[model samples]
Target: MEEDIQISFLNKLSCFFLIVLFLGCDTPGKILIKNETQDDVIYRYYKKETDENVAIDTVSIHVPALSEKYIILGFGSLWTESQLKSYIQNLQKIELIKATDTIVLKDKVEIYNYFKKRIKGVHKDEIEIIIK
Candidate 1:
């Protein structure tokens, strides 16, 4: 009876470890922004927390027409994974400005879904912004 109980406990422990490993592998570690447009674009992103807009930073990349550029969103080290996820979900707004025209992308289901999908899997999540 003692040996049986020991084996059962070992089996459960192994299973738990396997589950943790699988989940950790699937969690996304980075955010990728791809610019798919015909002109150079400037992207500005802000974090929306409790109805306040906190400016993160601005990125300027010369993504040529029909090309893609990758931008990594790096949060500070003080933030936990849950905090990062919440901040990503609450991304207030993104502005894509080219020349004199400005385009705005809001935080909605589509955007959330996009980020959620990117947050999973073995690769960084990518958001493709297209200007038409």
Candidate 2:
């Protein structure tokens, strides 16, 4: 009878530990998306990678009722137009470059997830990639 009781206690302890373990961890394949809704809100991140005070060209793309995309290209910062064009074209040809989503929370915890993209980053001449 004592042995059976001890076994039961051990099983209960094991189950409790397991419950605690699973509860304290984040499940894989789960990502958070945050939507920004406001006028004149700077939701995009642009890095010049240089200390030049040059004018940068930004392109914001929004499908009327569908999706949104933002691209910031700095003029005379580092990359030439041809280099940027080639890089953009190569990015478009990639197969797994899916949607880019951002998560914004209270207290300013923000992160960006590039979904379905096998390559996290690539190096190009005269330009540095920024992931936020």
Candidate 3:
């Protein structure tokens, strides 16, 4: 009877651990940048923290004329999901610098809504920037 009780307790503990593992498997929010352009583009990603715009990463990739690339940006533990989404939506400047030309994308209401929707799910958010 005591052996049976010990086995039952171990089973319960295993179940609990499995549940925790499944719950923790939820993917964090991310940013995906797809470059569909003729020339090689240099992209910079930034986040606003403590009232300052901090550059997170910079990548220069030669995306073919029709192909796409994904850039994943994860959220920090310091802020909630909503706060992180808001910060990304409110970003005033996102630049695609190519050669001597620089294109600036401003965050309008529609743009913010688009980003909010993209980053809403557990999947990574995606944005396609086309350079002419």
Candidate 4:
């Protein structure tokens, strides 16, 4: 009877471990680039590979006026904590290369509201930049 009880407990523990490993601790840090400008703004992100502010003229992430571009960084289970931290740190050194000037919004109450079912973030971690 004791052997059966131990086996059942072990099975339940294994199942719980699997669930936590796959679901609970696996979330990537996300960034949203909001273009509150008059015209369409074209911007790009780069990591400080060697601590040089090389002007990356490549026109990447495009956000229309009053729209947003969501970028996802760091893989959940694939990346270690240190690696994710390094990526975020490197982003800080990158310069904001924008085609147009930013127009600060007065009422940003719904700034973070997004349609999760329809919209998705670009999963290019190294190139994805910006937090606020």
lDDT of 2 by residue, 88-127 (tens): 4322121111145443322211111132231222222122
The weakest ten consecutive residues by lDDT in model 4 span 106-115
TM-score per prediction, in order, is: 0.43, 0.23, 0.45, 0.39
Better of 2 and 3 by lDDT: 3
lDDT of 3 by residue, 89-119 (tens): 5455566677668766566564456554444
Shift in Å, residue 96, candidate 4: 3.9
> Cα deviation in Å at residue 124, candidate 4?
19
Give the whole-model CA lDDT for all candidates, comma-separated: 0.57, 0.34, 0.55, 0.48
Report the lDDT tens digits of candidate 4 across residue range 8-123. Answer: 99999999999997864566655557766666665554444453667533336777767778666545522333544444444422234455344221222221121122233343
Name the regions of candidate 2 deviating beyond 4 angstroms. 27-132
Provide the clash count, candidate 3: 0
Highest TM-score scorer = 3
Q: Each candidate: RMSD to true structure?
A: 8.2, 16.8, 6.1, 10.2
CA lDDT, candidate 1, residue 83: 48
43-90, model 1: which lDDT tens digit per residue? 666555554464455444555566565554443312244544565676
Q: How many clashes in each structure?
A: 0, 0, 0, 0
By TM-score, rank the candidates, best first. Answer: 3, 1, 4, 2
The better-scoring model by TM-score among 3 and 4 is 3
